[model samples]
Target: MRILFIGDIVGRSGRTALSSRLPGLITEWKLDLVVVNGENAAGGFGITEAIYNEFIDAGADAVTLGNHSWDQREALVFIERAPRLIRPLNYPAGTPGRGAAMIEAKNGARALVINAMARIFMDPLDDPFAAIDRELAACPLGEGADAIVVDFHGEATSEKQAMGCFCDGRASLVVGTHTHVPTADHRILPARTAFISDVGMTGDFDSVIGMNKDEPLNRFLRKIATSRFEPASGPATLCGLAVETDAKGLAGKVAPVRLGGGLEEARPGFWP
Candidate 1:
């Protein structure tokens, strides 16, 4: 099974990049499953119903979310109807929408896509580790689903790495998001699951974490809010991780994906 996990999409720039490239990548890479983080797909805040549907139409099998999952306000209502849109698993029990989704892959296989959020320096939600364990137990990699992908959204790299190690043998891939900067450490774990501390944001990298530079600079320098933080409208570089799993739903090959804008271009060399 070939899986591609795109990092957070930060606004028009990120959405534009996904729309322009994802369809072709599905055909070109022969991807069986695609999951993208869309917490910041709105005006640099939360995702909207339209953006969620756009991701689905663009061939994303499942769209994941993080702390900003409720920024748009409308997402709270629309997400209940969007089966493929998953929010953090460790959210309060009554939180709207689901944490995990069973998506039928393009190849007719089932992929269990889970979105989990860490607690370190983040919302004091339920235990993400225990939540992930429960999901993985209910749907064992090779038995319940052909593939298992976990998007651990967090602010701490250590916590992300811990989640990756915690789900090492149970999931097909464990990738991080929310940091908005691709890390150098992306490799298959000892148990065969692919792991990366941060998959980066699929938005313009020229600014401060996908936001326009001036405002952040102002706040940093003046220590006061002069204006709202807006999404950078420059050309974006789509960032993500590519993993090819084995027969037992364990990752066999992994690579980083970055294209356009500021970052150096990259694609899975194992694929065409």
Candidate 2:
């Protein structure tokens, strides 16, 4: 199975980039599943029903969320109805919508997609490791599942990497999101999971991790905050990880996916 995991979709530019490029990438890579992090899909806050549908129609097999999952109040209802959209599993037990789901690929391969947020540098949440343990136990690798991808929504790279190692071999891919900056550590772990510290944001790369640079620059220079964070109006970059998984739910190869206009040298896809 070929899986593409896109990072946080910032605002309009992010959506526009996704709408324009995803379909082509899906065809070019022959992707079996596409998971998008939509926590910031709506004006750098949360996802809306309209935006959610746009992603689905644009070829997203599943949409994952981060800490800002509830920023858009409307998502509460939309997420519940949309089984393909998932919030962090570590969220309080009663949180609306589920943290994981099974999405069937074009070839009828069942892929288990799980989303979990880390506690470090974020709000208190349930033990993600334990939460995932139960999930994997319930739907163990193979047995019928072709692949398992985990969207580790987190801030600290240490936490994200820890989760990846913890879930190595158990999951087909453990890609990180939430810092909005792509990390260069894309590789197949010893346990066979395609792992990356952070897949970055699918928005304007010229700005501060997709937001306008002025506000972040000001905050860094002046001790106090002065301006609101706004999405950068520029050519967007689609950032994510592309991985090829074997039939037994293990990653065969992995690479960082970057497209459109953006920073860093990027290419489409490669086997290694």
Candidate 3:
């Protein structure tokens, strides 16, 4: 099974690049499933129903969320109805939506997608480790589902790495998001799970993780708050990871997927 996982989609530019290039990429790579982190899809805040549908229409099989999952007030209700959308698994029990979802790919392959948020330098929530364990148990790797893909939406690289190692043999792929800067360490873990510290953002690289750099730089220089930060309007780069899982639901190979314009080097798939 070939899967493509895209990082945080920022604002208009990110969406534009995605809408224009994704269809071609999907067809060219012959992807079976595609998951995109859309927490920042709506003007760099939270995803909206319309934008969510747009991503799904643009080739994303499932859309994942992070800390900003509920930024838009409407999402509280919209998310409950959207089956392809997934929020952090560690959220409170009564949270509006689910943290994991199961979907059948075009080729009739079953995939279990999980979204989990890390607690380090993040909001205090249920233990992600425990939350993931419970979620994965609900959909045991190959028997309950054909493959498993986890989006470790987090901050600390160490925590993300630990989570990847934790789910190594259990999942087909364990990729990180939220950092918005693609790491160079994309490889198959010891247990055959495809792992990457951060899949990066699908936004303007000229700014600070998709936000305007001026405001952040000012805050650092003066040690005082000034204006609100906004998403960068410049050219955006679509960043993420791609993996090919074998018949047994273990990742056989992985690659960092970077494309379009912006500040960073874009690397496409190296395997068929």
TM-scores, all candidates, are: 0.99, 0.96, 0.97
lDDT of 3 by residue, 69-162 (tens): 9999999999988999999999998999999999888678999999999999999989999999987877888888898999999999999999
Off by over 4 Å in 3: 263-269
Give the per-residue lDDT of model 1 (tens digit) for 1-272.
98999999999999999999999999999999999999999999999999999999999999999999998999999999999999999998899999999999999999999999999999999999999999999999999999999999999999999999999999999999999999999999999999999999999998999999999999999999999999999999999999999899999999999999999999999999
Give the number of the best model, judged by TM-score: 1
Q: Candidate 2: list runs displaced more than 4 Å.
A: 268-272
Off by over 4 Å in 1: none
Question: Top model by lDDT, which number?
Answer: 1
Q: Could you report the Cα RMSD, in angstroms, for every candidate shown?
A: 0.6, 1.5, 1.2
RMSD of 2: 1.5
Ranking the candidates on TM-score from highest down gives: 1, 3, 2
lDDT of residue 178 for candidate 3: 93
lDDT of 2 by residue, 5-124 (tens): 998999999999999999988887788889999999898999999999999999999999989999999888878899999999989877899999999986789999999989898998
**Clash pairs detected, candidate 2:** none
True lDDT of residue 55, candidate 3: 96
